[model samples]
Target: MLVIRGLGSQYGRISVLRSVNLVIGRHQLIALVGANGAGKTTLLRTISGVQKASSGQIEFDGKDITQLRADKRVKIGICHAPEGRHVFGPLSVEDNLHLGAYSRADKAEIAADLERNYAMFPVLKQKARLPAGTLSGGQQQMLAIARALMGRPRLLLLDEPSMGLAPLLVEEIFNAVTELRKRKITILLVEQNANAALAIADQAYVMETGEIVLSGSGKELLGNERVREAYLGI
Candidate 1:
């Protein structure tokens, strides 16, 4: 449903992504795994229109959207849950979630989606009136994902969803992501945790130094010698 071709981006004189090409099929979970400085986040940011690409094409569902603004991308069903769960600290959990649906005009649909998000993340329902900043790290991450869902995204971009949580919380987050896939939400997951990311991905890509170095079925890449040594820690 999403296609990126010959994508290149630079920060001033320093190029971060070079001719990056990728395609995500409808309702598929595609994982992008790489170490620090591998341009994974940069690629997502560029796709979401938060960062400008020096050259390349970004097409979503057959529409060329490389020049679209970030908010416009969100309206087009591209919701990004950034690395840091940037929730509004002072806002109530319910309020934070409501903000996510700001792009929509239907108040009734927004309210219904809010209920669905609460059902998806029960913890959010329990903390509906509490300030977002008062929640635990794991809860905050849940809130972030829940908030994104409030936007009714067709293509979700998740950057390091398991970053600072405990192992159990990481498992919970991954499980939630897997559930989202079952619901047919197309996902582009950028993660440093290769094992977890690949475990649930339909397809996986390994990147190095701003370029795709490996692409394969998740199981195929998981068993690869180089991937085993570098990412799987086998």
Candidate 2:
């Protein structure tokens, strides 16, 4: 559903992504794994239109979206859950979720999506009136995912969804991501936890120092000698 060709980006004068080429099929779960500063986040931000690409093309559903603004990208069904779970601290959980649907004009559809999010994340429903900051890290992560779902995204960009949580909570978050896959939500997951991410991904790419060095079926990547030695710690 998305294609990126010869993608390059730089922050000021420092290049972060170099000639990155990637293709994601509809309803596919693709994981991008690498060490810190590998430019995974930069790639996602560029695709989501938050960061401009220095060169190359971004195509979504056969149309070029390289020049589209972030909000315009959202209207075209691309939603990003950034590295930090940046939920509004002071806003109630429901309000925060509601903000995600701001691009839509149909109240009934928005309400239906709200109900669907509540069903997927019952905890968010229970804490609907509570401030988002009051939730635990895991809960906050769930809220972040649920908030993004509120936008009814066709392709979801997840950046480090399990970053700071405990092991059990991390498992919970991964389980939720697995459920998203079952629901046929196309995902471009950028994660540091290579093992868990690869386990759940249909396809995986390994990046290092701003370039894609490896790409394969997730199971193949999990067993790769170089991948095991470098990222999996096997």
Counting clashing residue pairs in each candidate, in order, gives 0, 0
What TM-score does structure 1 among the candidates reach? 0.98
Deviation in Å, model 1, residue 123 alpha carbon:
1.3
Q: Across residues 23-57, which tens digit of lDDT does each residue of candidate 1 receive?
A: 99999999999889999999999988999999989
User: Per-residue lDDT tens digits of candidate 2, residues 21-66?
Assistant: 9999999999999999999999999999999999999999999999
**Predicted structure 2: clash tally:** 0
In model 2, what are the clashing residue pairs, if there are any? none
Give TM per candidate.
0.98, 0.98
